[model samples]
Target: MYVFSAQRRAISIICIYMTYPYTTWQNCVYSIDRR
Candidate 1:
């Protein structure tokens, strides 16, 4: 049970981080396109 919860938390954190990376990548692309 403890292992399952730990995996869930890790997955959640990974998902959040992945989203953040994608957003930053998109923002960078937009800025470059604007220029």
Candidate 2:
């Protein structure tokens, strides 16, 4: 059970890292469009 929980946590972290850049870029584009 511990191992499975750890694996899930790792996957969640990786997903967040992968999406973080795209989210930041989207926010930047939105700000530029507002200007």
Candidate closest to the true structure, highest TM-score: 2
Q: Please give the distance, in angstroms, between residue 15's alpha carbon in candidate 2 and its true position after superposition.
A: 0.5
**TM-score for each prediction?**
0.41, 0.43
Which window of 10 residues has the lowest lDDT sum in candidate 2?
24-33
* Residue 34, model 2, lDDT: 62
Whole-model lDDT per candidate: 0.54, 0.54
> Model 2: which residue pairs collide?
none
1-35 per-residue lDDT for model 2 (tens digits): 13446655565566567668676544543454466
Summarize candidate 1's per-residue lDDT along 1-35 as a digit string, tens digits.
13436655565555567667566544543454466
